[model samples]
Target: MNHQSVDVNTAQSFVPKVSVVIPIYNGEADLPDLLSCLLSQTYPKEQVEYLLVDNNSSDRTLSILQTTAENSPITIRPLSENNIQSSYAARNTGIKAATGEIIAFTDADCRPQPQWLNTLIQPFINPEVVIVAGEILALPGTSLLEKFADKQETLSQKHTLAHKFCPYGQTANLAIRQHIFTKSGLFRPYLTTGGDADICWRILKANLGKLEFADDAIVQHRHRVTIKELSSQWRRYGRSNRYLHELHGIELTREIKTKEYIYILLRWLLKEVPKISIQNIIGQASFADLFNTPLGLFTSRERSLGQKKAQLPENAKVIEWF
Candidate 1:
């Protein structure tokens, strides 16, 4: 669907300089830190409008939001019904209500640096640029697992930057023109996972324009601890990949084929099992280095393909694969 272009000058005149939309789930514990960081931004308060969308979180998240709004200069909007619970849905809600020409996005668990907003909006000086993605730094933690997750996230960012075709945005630290959402028809609601990637895919397909990587727009993310948490995260990512496949005619890469995935998993077990059993060995090699990363890529392709396939009805005479 084609998006109606808003007159840049007129929109800018009516709206604030930038509208920062944060979608909150059950994240009461992290609200204070996130708000503190936002309040301390070096950017002028009058130039930026902070909008918080609460996704009907059942915890103290709403109460905290209300209290924080009283002390801070942020606007808090609570959803009437929790019908749509995902972050993507929540963000879409925020976009519809935002008044800024430049719509900035960040997660509730992320704390942006003082220069974050300034850096994120700088690229928008060029009207052609529609999307701006920034760097995500993991906060220091005592747990080794947490530190490992941080390192992995950093590596992922670097890899994402290295790829030109795969240039994407993370909600944790991203900004885009308000018209993009208005024109692009928001994110894919059915995709419970990899919604960020799905949105990026659509943006690129629309030929909306270039996506800029602003390294100076930095935000600190809190890493999840424990292997169980990591595994669950990755699995959900896999399922999301399936959704993507259903929407777009794409599948997993050759590296992420089922056989290769299992092979790498077994290889990691064989290599690390003995080391883990040793008396003095504390750190065993992890298979994530081999399978998980590639698996994610494969899963993304598969999800894209699956999504496309499902969209076609029976006897539709869709193009057949060789």
Candidate 2:
């Protein structure tokens, strides 16, 4: 690591070292783009270290990490977590190996904006703030499912932070003080889903610190491009909802009756469908976006109903959806 010289006459500036932890599982296709974004970050390279954790990947993910670390100007540590299949477990491994005071997290598929790290770390300048949740938006997509996901703001942190029990940020774009982990304990290594919520709530419960949102700290994520992929994503969310309810007493959305389901479907088709038009969708949407935006809600709800009758697994293999 290189250090910049500072004049002793004036007080030196405070720049907290940041460790970016990303957990990956067969992310070969998306790794290049994500790495490019990381390498192009506007943040001081000397102050940031990236820990890319591979969670039992069966692809060329390990090879890519090795190649990047060899040629990259920034510090890149390629680590592995094969003992547990969960992404949270992989993250815990990265956390243990991280050397920075403030640890930031993004997925292997997420593309951070150039100013992401610089803006994300700014909140920690205040003593009261311990967690920083950055904004997540979808990368532009060509498929109907992808456009629908983008229109719905599927990756937004707003809804997650608005949880009734406690506000929490998804791991896609979040930063936390390293000391908070020691006080709150690391994330439940076995949790395949809802681990972000679990950890943030634990920190708040322990009175360790508070969380903040950074609007300018942005990361773009690729949305699922097919119906099967979209459905799988919602199913995971449903299972997460069930797990969270069991752990934190968070209430699940009541199941709709047969009559109510019919009513909603009819209402959406009869009343809402006609309201959409080229005028409203000109610059903002495509034909896919115009039709799928309203229809996706029903599909998402039905897909998420997996939690209603789902059995929680003891140690489920974490699937990388991004």
Candidate 3:
């Protein structure tokens, strides 16, 4: 998907300056590789800059960013947003500090491909595209939980177009025009999760600009390998659902019901059965997918806890693992 290159700033050009913002709490293990990748990006350094905001990390995340800032090709603005314990809050801080018309957001744990920024910013060439959803694939890990995490992300991003109003945009690989913030508003700082959907929904409902999917613009996310980590991740998602629904005036009695268990099992069976390479029933079946159905029960339970917090005036609970 090589789009014709647009000048960084031309009177009638769509290519405008871009600011890539990455929000992290404790990302020492992941930040270096991501920063190195950014330095290798094909996007014009003169037209692009980066903002790595720390949410008061008590780890080496700050030192690493300071070091990376000293060596990165483009200007790297290191900022802080510690008052709120939400990545969305950190992102808003970066948004305020950004000088580019195009603001791209990626997680600190993600290792973006070299062409990532170049590809992501391409759709902006249309001028009408205000929000772009780039592709996210999981970096391989040994654990089945890691594999499950990968599978879940693929499903989550792919099926978003079916959503009636706001097509989903994960911060792992999302780019938005700066003006969208002026019109659609910034990420809800109160939200610890799903603020991406909340803002994109706001934009769509307002008919601000085109929301396009850029499949070639990709990011590789580090999947949660342990059960505890995966459960915590889904719980935030569960809680965010409540917040989003409330904000939209949509109400649901149950987040997960008994009937859903059956549906999930059937859905997994249908999707996995056809691709089996074995003739024997055991060989044809995937135990991991089978286990994922029941795991959904645990994750949904976590979601229930989040929905419970949504009832509180201030949903400030933070998932430490995130």
Maximum-lDDT candidate: 2
What does candidate 2's lDDT look like per residue over 1-322, in tens digits?
Answer: 0112334332125578899999999999989898999999988899999999999999999989999999999999999999988899899998999999999999988999999998787777667788899999988888877777776787899889888788999999999999888777787788888899888887887788778888778999889877677777888888888888877788886665777767877886786666655445655435664567345666657655867866656553232221
Q: TM-score for all predictions?
A: 0.74, 0.89, 0.82
Candidate 2's displacement at residue 21, Å, is 0.5
Report lDDT (CA) for all predictions.
0.66, 0.82, 0.75
| Cα lDDT for residue 22, candidate 1 | 85
Alpha-carbon runs more than 4 Å astray in model 3: 1-15, 154-156, 251-287, 312-322
Total clashing pairs for each candidate: 20, 0, 0
Tens-place lDDT per residue, model 1, 1-322, is 1123446665344433788888888888888898889888876677777778888798888777777777666454443226666777677777777778888999898989998887777777667789888888888776755655664664245555454446577788888888787556676543456667667767878898778888777888876676556555655655544555556655643234567667765765686445545523444544333334444444344444443333322222121111
TM-score, structure 2 vs. true: 0.89
Error of 1 at 181 (Å): 2.0
In terms of TM-score, the best-performing candidate is: 2
lDDT tens readout by residue for model 3, 34-86 = 77888888877888889999998999888878887887667998898889888
**What is candidate 1's CA lDDT for residue 151?**
47
Model 1, CA-based lDDT: 0.66
